[model samples]
Target chain A: MNKTEYLKSLSNELGHMPYGDVKDIIQSIEEHFDEGLGEGRSEEEIAASLGDPKELAAEFKDGVKFNQIMKKRKRLKDYAGPDGRGRIFVILFNAFVGIECWLLLLAAIIAAFCFLAADLAFIGLIVAGLITGTLTEFMVPFIFLILTLACVAVFLVALLILGIKYYAKGLKSYIRWNKNIWNYGLGED
Target chain B: MNSQIKKGILDLCVLALLEKGDSYGYDLAGSLARKVEVADGTVYPILRKLASEGVVSTYLQESQNGPPRKYYHLTDAGRRKLDSERDEWIKFCGEVNEILERGETGGKADE
Candidate 1:
């Protein structure tokens, strides 16, 4: 009997899998065929090597069903919140960084304008104090310098921490995602 | 011989026999039993799988003794698979030998 006829009958007997999955299974078998042909083996010789297709199909079907179950489990995990609201914490943390970035930018701009305005105010104060004949006017320049340096330092540190955390979160998600999938596949029947 | 390994290879052995020519279930089982141990029911499942994968085909024929017998024949696809698996076995064995020569596991032949 022809291979096509046998495959058709088998597909009918199995009641057909998802169309995409069926195509994938067929493609894997065909790959074996191509590899055999490349090695100069005849069709008859190669066909006998694979043993039974039913067992392989069973293995494939089991794997697919297992993946679906794992996907559902992941959805549940996202809602259930592992490690005492770790997912919620991550979400809030990300939002905090976004808002922090905008605030920092605004602060820096205000600080810059204030520094300029403070310099102008200090000059004005010194001039007025000079006119009034006071010696305590020199303290204004020192105060403005300290405030600008402190605000700038804080902004730089926040941005740097945000960048590092972004990368860390990305790597963390990748490892956890793969670990969950692996565990699911291994535990499946 | 390791039973697990033998059992795993049983299906391959049966397919190899069929590579020679088409035969019914009884003859195939008998031929395999001579060379290796096999469960009475092992061949049936293997046949079902092979037929399902389009590697083999079956047709019923009336016989003289009691009832109609089912005959199995290998298809082109099945032959191709057998040959490729046979090559893989050869390559895998060669690598195992190399590992053994390097004194790995004291040359224990366990897969």
Candidate 2:
């Protein structure tokens, strides 16, 4: 089919995704054609080998979302930046950040509650000591204080872990997205 | 030769070709199909994506036979993009070749 007609048909078959995504999917498929053609494949043969355009469009839509396509495009420079290693690191880092942020918030809240509880326990112990004169009151409060302090330390550590995790995971995801079709839902990379 | 592989590489191939010069969609598609097998309809989405990305630009031109035809031209960004991707493609293919050679011939012969 002609280019416009082909796209229109593909759109129809693919359930007509957003115009932007539809366009990106088309571009991605075209690039594949160019590569095969450059290697000396015939047009009719290539077209036939590629199977139905509608089916192909569905495959393309599977892995690659419009957002990821944009991310992939934006990341082209970064992929080429410095060493290839860093790009992977960057993607991993992004994912890590997302994970870390969620965990850190959880840790922080947990720490705060522990801290308050520990302080309350400590006050309660002092009161008990004044009223009853036993070392038991002091011990419970002290233990609570220690536990609260430990939670505080854990919270800080979590922040660091989050930072490192995002870098690694973000990079991994980006690289995987770029090379693998199944990862993005485009098909098999 | 696999439909999956062809579907994956078509867009990159078109963008790479357009980096050389402007051309109508059919001409580009036909040229590409000559090299890699694909449906005529396969090239359109790729063109649309490239155009939308600002990597390539399209303008309507009067056709001798009938309605206006959209001709695609590579932008500077597109050219740079193609250049960078071209580099990556070479490196990736080279690695693939190395793997195949190592696996089948132990570097003693070409496959």
Candidate 3:
């Protein structure tokens, strides 16, 4: 299957998961395809390497669902102890989490892509600067231009790295957030 | 072996690799699968679990060929887990190896 089809089937299989989780997982998988291309791999090769999405989904469901059951049992005990306010806490918490999940994913997505775009732009500038230097036979000016482009390229690359790091950190927070929703979003004591 | 057991081993292997340095998902998977039999996508789920547990964290690094890669790094918690698990595994395997090798001599003793 192609990237879109693979992601669609995976998400469908993961239909029971928390909404934010499904988005983050699918986004990371999409990023995987992009990375695979970087490694000189075709979509089929990457998909094949990824093995079965259904199995992947099953593992995810197993880990998170297992935790959910345990937390659910704990929450049940707390609610059973004559605490009416606990019910409202559970409802309000899940409602707030449900609404904010996708927005978190969107912010990370935009940050990652912005840095990526900037990185590419600098690479393009370097190439253009080099070509211009070659055609004019201005060796000294060309050297200066290329060196300046290289310095900017390095700086952009660093920024791209930092952006990606922040994006990943944010994604992990979302994963933890999603896991909490499954495992303790029910107002666990 | 059961898949759960295999997955546990895979988890340890991933941790050990990350303990050495950070690695992107596909690269880490490729390294582990080379050393052990595994499905291609298995590492991603393991990664998600680790991330949730605060045992591992991730970042993006651009590769020469494709889009940026999300690299996994071991946290302090992951390192501790790996150390304890590795010790347990070694002891467990040493005992099992001793038991299995005795089969060679046990047959002779019975005769």
Candidate 4:
């Protein structure tokens, strides 16, 4: 393909793009051809080395799309800058409503811990009875009680670990949400 | 090399080249095509992308022979990007090489 044919194919492929962009792309490629021709290279040589026009056009489209996305992201970031009114509102809301919710969560976690401690204490008493031969007369029943308590303790420990993990995670995300509201005024991400 | 992989590295390559000196589309493409296995046309889109990202800026300058030539220059952001990307590429290559070397030694030991 000659320079004219190559450019025509590229222009045709870039029909979806704005006219200004298509013209600019063509002009740049045209300059490239002129430079190659100046260096005593044939049109076919330059065109062949430029690869496929359709592929080139596709790359151009991708470049345009990438640019648009970058621009949109920059605008969104600019919009997300700190706002004083939002900050005040977030502070007031957090102080009144959010604190209560946090306190309730803290209370629930503490209650669960207390329940687990009580269970452990009961298990301890059973072991003590077994060691001191106080429950030897009812060995089968004591064994059954120990086994059941052990399972319950294991289950509580697992549950407490999981609950604490989720509690920490929830606290972190809630704090992040407060900060986001302070900064971006409840704007959708 | 995979085309997707090549496409990504090409951005770094263009930045590296522009760091050395300002160049026009043809000259830049020619320099890259000489060393890398890519079509000369591929550099233009990369240049356009870099320009859009504010890493590189273009200006038109008069040529001695014919019409004015469009030149691509590296911005400060482009330099910083190049430094970070070069570091990442080196670190990644080091990791891949270590893995490959370990695999080779392991295969030898099995044999």
Q: What is candidate 3's TM-score for chain A? A: 0.43
CAPRI quality level assigned to candidate 4 from its DockQ score: medium
lDDT order of candidates, top first: 4, 3, 2, 1
lDDT of 2 by residue, B1-111 (tens): 786766666767998788678887667766887887665555666776667678889887886654565689989898888888789888998999999878877655653
| DockQ of all models, two decimals each | 0.02, 0.09, 0.37, 0.61
Best prediction by lDDT: 4
Which residues of candidate 1, in runs, are more than 4 Å off?
A1-189, B101-111
lDDT of each: 0.59, 0.64, 0.76, 0.91
Predicted candidate 2 versus true structure: per-residue lDDT over A114-163, tens digit per residue: 66566556656665665676766577765666577667656656655675
Prediction 1 TM-score vs. true: 0.35
Q: Which ten residues in a row have the lowest lDDT in candidate 2 chain A?
A: A180-189
- Worst ten in a row by lDDT for model 3 chain A: A180-189
Q: Could you estimate the TM-score for every candidate?
A: 0.35, 0.44, 0.61, 0.63
lDDT of 3 by residue, A1-189 (tens): 888889999999999687999998898888778777766899988888788899989988877876668656766665444444544654566579744765666676576567657756765765676677644566566567667766766776676678667766766775665555454444542
lDDT of 4 by residue, A47-139 (tens): 999999999999999999988787658656779467788888888998899989989988988987898899889889988998999888988
The reply for model 3, stretches above 4 Å from the true place, is A69-189, B60-68
Q: Is candidate 1 or candidate 2 better by lDDT?
A: 2
